[model samples]
Target: MMKIDLQKEFNDYTQNLNKASKDQHINTAITRAVKAYRSTVAESLERFPHTPEMAAEVREIKTQAMANNSELLAQAMASVERNKGKAFYARDRQQALEIAAGIIGTGKTVVKGKSMLGEELHLREYLEEKGNEVWETDLGEFILQLKKDRPMHILSPAIHVPREQVAEIFSKFFNKDVPPEIAEEVGVVREFLREKYFSAHVGISGANVVAADTGAMVIIENEGNVRLASGAPPVHIVMVGIEKIVPTFQEAMKTAEVTWRYAQYGVPGYVNIVSGPSKTGDIEKVTTYGAHGPKEFYVIFVDNGRSEMAKDEKFSQALHCLRCGGCMYECPVFQVTAGHFGHTYLSGIGAVWTAFVSGGLEKAAPLVYTCLRCGRCMERCPMQINVPAMIGELRNRIVNGAAQGEEPLPQVAHS
Candidate 1:
């Protein structure tokens, strides 16, 4: 293996961080987003005062879920198969990509919902490379797709792209003079993706929580894109992390509720619970598959390092994250740099995720050091993940080299 240049990585990361911190678009967008998130989350908490208590209960649920992750994974896959949906377990990124490609094949148009997993696996880029046209249906994701940029926030992918820039991107893409009006911009994209939804051969999404008992994939979304993307296409494919599975449906509901609540959504516009392919029994009182919705449903449970993360006691809590994006609002570094402080994931929590799931420890070194360890993010985090503690453990491993027989640690310079 090529030796990683820790000095160069730190220098380049710092340069990017400094540059991002000074960007006017990132400043304006993050400021507005932080304010809105705080206000909305406060109101949401007040409206549903039970959320914190529910979150506490969900924490236990997550703890147990992580402990029995292997059992839950097997049960969930069996439930999916029982429900008539094909289930796949991908041990790594390559296997995940290959399975999806085998199902999708080449020369197909795919409309996909917003999925951080998709970003982690570079699913869209991979499919396109395999000769498929893929469209990101979420408005923010669509904007990023057109702008050729990655997500700046988990919930709000293009959070750094202000409306002015959006209008510019929209104008260039649509080949028209789209003004800097949010409504008009939305209308144009809505008009464009409406056709892609019905015409696309496949639709892809990520689940917020999975119920091992019923094989249900619960997706919480404010935007209606997931509904269309999953419903309109003949084939619906769900790519979710194995850590999302819970033992029971009721616990899954609790998990989903807490997730949306902390995500600043008082009540998400859509809570889709998909178990299997759409079916009907009308004509002769006989059951039939493929009504007006998707005829085929496939679920790929991606493990790509998540299993390893769950096994380690110090890092297992990181897998409990609901991806609410609330911690980013409270994170001082994230407030200033947005997603520049991250790799595929963002903020303090993201650093832990990058270390385990998306990118390994070496890739996560810069982000690990970026954390202020003020514990402000914990105050806002629904999971109350001890990110500072995790960061400290990562730093020790980086400095002293990884545990016996693990990947050799890079030579990182002390500040």
Candidate 2:
């Protein structure tokens, strides 16, 4: 085994954090976003007083789901296959990318919805390297794609980018004058991605939750891009983390509802539940697939160190994250430095995720120490994840070298 030097990693991360703390764009954008998020979430909770109670129930569901993850994963895959869809399990990032590339051959166009799992695997860049033209259909993701920038927030990927910067990005990409108006900015992207949605050979997305009993991919979105992207193409591919699966459809719905409520959406514009490929039995009692949607469907359940995290009692709770991103707004370090405070995942929870999923303890060492441990993030987290406690445990591991035997996953660089 080789010794690792974390001093330079720490120094580089510190420089980036300090630079981001002083960036006017990040400060202004996050300030506005935090204000709006707080107001919206408060009103949403007030409107649906039962949301917190439901969230508590969802927590139990997540706990049980994680405990029985392997069984549920097997059942979910079987259900997908039974429903006329292909199912795959990727033990690591490389295999996950290869499976997707095989499905979508070279020189094909792909339109994709926003997916953090996709980010964890660096899917878009990988597909592009394989000779495919991939277009991000989500508005914020589209902006980041054109600018060649990484996500600044989980739910709102380009939260650090204000409308003015978005206009500049759009103008440069489209070679036309785009105003800083929010509605106009959205209209241009809509017009541009509309063509890609219908013309693309494959469509890809990540699910908010998966129902093991029925093999349903439940996706919650507001932009309507997912509907077009997944429905308009000849092939639809779903790349989701194994942690997203639940035991039953009803439990899945409860989880999805709690997810949206905390995400500042009272009721998301769309909640798509796709079980299998499109089919119809109207022609003389004969069944046929591809009746207005993708003829082929595939689901890749990725386990890039997730199973290891699930088996560890001390850190299993981190897998319960809904990715609603409510906690980031309440995090002091995150509010100031935005995504620069952490890596692929952001903030305190991101630190834990980076250790188990994205990067190893070496990459997570700096982020683990950066946490202020004020407990504000826990108060806002719907799952009530003990981020401060996790940070403390990670620090102990670093000092005692308890993580020495663990193998680090391949690093995926984010801009």
Candidate 3:
């Protein structure tokens, strides 16, 4: 693991923010992407006129679902077992990694779908250290993997990488001459990952939403890679945050719809739902597992400070995030600094999340203060989380310290 110096991180973030503000290449790219995202979301909202009502219903469903989080989790585990799938609950990051490693044992080749939970756990690095070859199959994630860079945007992981840089990276990766055209670059990636998809012995992913009643895991993606990654392998493993659970399949589908809508898609290209291992009853009136898709299915629900966050009513709303990433595009500070003004997560919402999940005020100190309290993020948020208000609360906590006897560990933010 890389050693973290909190003071250094804060200073470097400030320097990067200053540098990003002056870099035309980066500023232009971010502006173009943010503008295009707004236009797409606007058009999609028009097409899906009932989105507001659906959003309201999903909000209530998520709130109620989270209120009974423990019960819902037990039901989900039972439902998964009833469906003949293995389920585990991980209390923290290390345990989550151990559960994933145990499923995809050593000396195996693994193909992974895009998972922010995977990032949170640093699963790829851990697996590689344990003697496994892990390949990220999502187009954006694959590019970031090759570049050895973190995601600049939640929806568009490699949003910071322009086409020219992608072409150069691909050329170096393949050791061949590659054109800078977007289509050509995409073809290069497709041809290379197609073999890995079939050859990998295990596949891993994160669920967008899980149904407690049916143990169904719903994943929405624009690319077809997630289907290939999760289906082709004999053993499929999923790592999801506990907050992703919804009460029923209907509510889960509604949640998925709201997610894609705000993610700038009228309807996602693929909405893959896997209840358990693939089964068929074609011969002798008997059902058989491993008919075509994955034969073994496992899910690990990670807590990792989420339960603690849920205990605080003011901060618990962070768990309601759909990861649609609309708020980042609407954030004025994020529009300028991109991901530099962020910690583990990004933008105004990220500040609150980092404060609770990643660490306390120390980790969030630098980014939280960057929020202008403009309320634009709340306007764009599908869940309508009050980011500005959350930032203010965190700021108060830092200044005043936690209650009567808690440690005062808030790292001071440098201007």
Candidate 4:
């Protein structure tokens, strides 16, 4: 009962995942994160009864976009170029990393918003390796940044950490008499991130939705840190998946509402949207690019097997996630095993994304059975996406077997 260290939980979850059988600690991390998400998203789900209808719309958006993927990509590319911004289409991770490195230059301190895409690219680690100072601005991500661990919950990075351990970590880092309270821990981080907001030379973020119509980048966050990250820095960089493209800002707004409701569970603690790096064109009746805004803006469109995910019947639904992370919370299996449920991406959704992006069935086999198969997450989804259904799809692939003796799943707790 020392209260779990979320950072430590992530560390332990990954470190011991392959070595030992499932333990209570792994269960603790997974369960706790899942619970937090489910409890909150449930209330929000009730707010909108149009969820089923909305889901159909979302599917339509996806279908229209995917059917003409090359055309959609062209539109998005053109829009970004028209906005006086630079866009790069990364065929894979290595290409994306190279694009980021060449643009970031050297000796610049970077402040990053919470972006799972950045995580996929290991952007912070890479920037650090290049001797650039990088700071995470999301409260959960910031804590994990201090602990140097991967994210547990997608939305809440430090969801694995209990309040008491958070107190300990914050206390040690601040060197102040940090209160042994969860509310206080959050407050402390808000205050701490203030300096990082203004001092950063560059900002890195992930886009929730990218509007192909206006070449606008839409970000949704409960905290205002993403706003500060993109606004404060002279240069703003967004690492976005190709699937994030939507037709218009109006469509983007509708999706944003759904995405926000999904994350907030009721009403978000806060929500912010950014349109091309905070520009001010009002002075002297002339527009300026760097006037209290970023002089340079780069959006990296990462393919990273997303193109592969588009064609699959069952698995393609993973692209429609909207980054809600609601499924992980509702998943009983994810609740206990924490990230044991995923690979880089954790939980049921992560399993699909991991199989598509990170590793295939061979790497994802152990995680396939972790689901309790409960439908709570799907019920709460604004798009009403069937996460459990997709997990089943992955399971079929595993049971059917692939690659011939690529290591079968260990006997986990649940089938």
Single out the weakest 10-residue window by summed lDDT for candidate 1: 406-415
* Local error of candidate 2 at residue 128 (angstroms): 0.3
Q: What count of clashes does model 4 give?
A: 9
Tens-digit lDDT string for candidate 4 (1-415): 1232235534554565543235644456656555565666565567676755766677678667666676777898888888888888999988998898888877878889898888888888888888788889888888888887778778877767766777888889999878888788889888877887788788989988888888878887767888888888899988899988888877777777777776754555545555564566697867677888788888889999988888765556678778877666666666555555677887667777888887666555556656556777676565566667777667765555433224344323222
Report the Cα lDDT for residue 377, model 2. 86
Model 3 clashes, total count: 0
lDDT tens digits by residue: candidate 2, 110-196: 999999999999999999999999999999899999989999999899988888888998899899999999999999998998889
lDDT of 3 by residue, 84-186 (tens): 9999999999999999898888999999999888887888999999999999988889999999988888888888888889999999999998888999999
Using lDDT as the yardstick, the better of models 3 and 4 is 3
In model 4, pairs of residues that clash are 6-160, 6-161, 27-336, 30-334, 30-335, 30-338, 31-335, 31-336, 34-329
Global Cα lDDT for candidate 4? 0.74
Candidate 2: the clashing residue pairs are: none
- Model 1 stretches astray by more than 4 angstroms: 1-3, 404-415
What lDDT would candidate 2 get against the real structure? 0.93
Q: Model 1 over residues 151-240: C-alpha lDDT tens digits?
A: 999999999998999999999999999999999999999999999999999999999999999999999998899999999999999999
Q: What's the lDDT for residue 324 in model 1?
A: 94
TM-score on alpha carbons, each prediction: 0.96, 0.96, 0.95, 0.84
lDDT per prediction? Answer: 0.93, 0.93, 0.88, 0.74
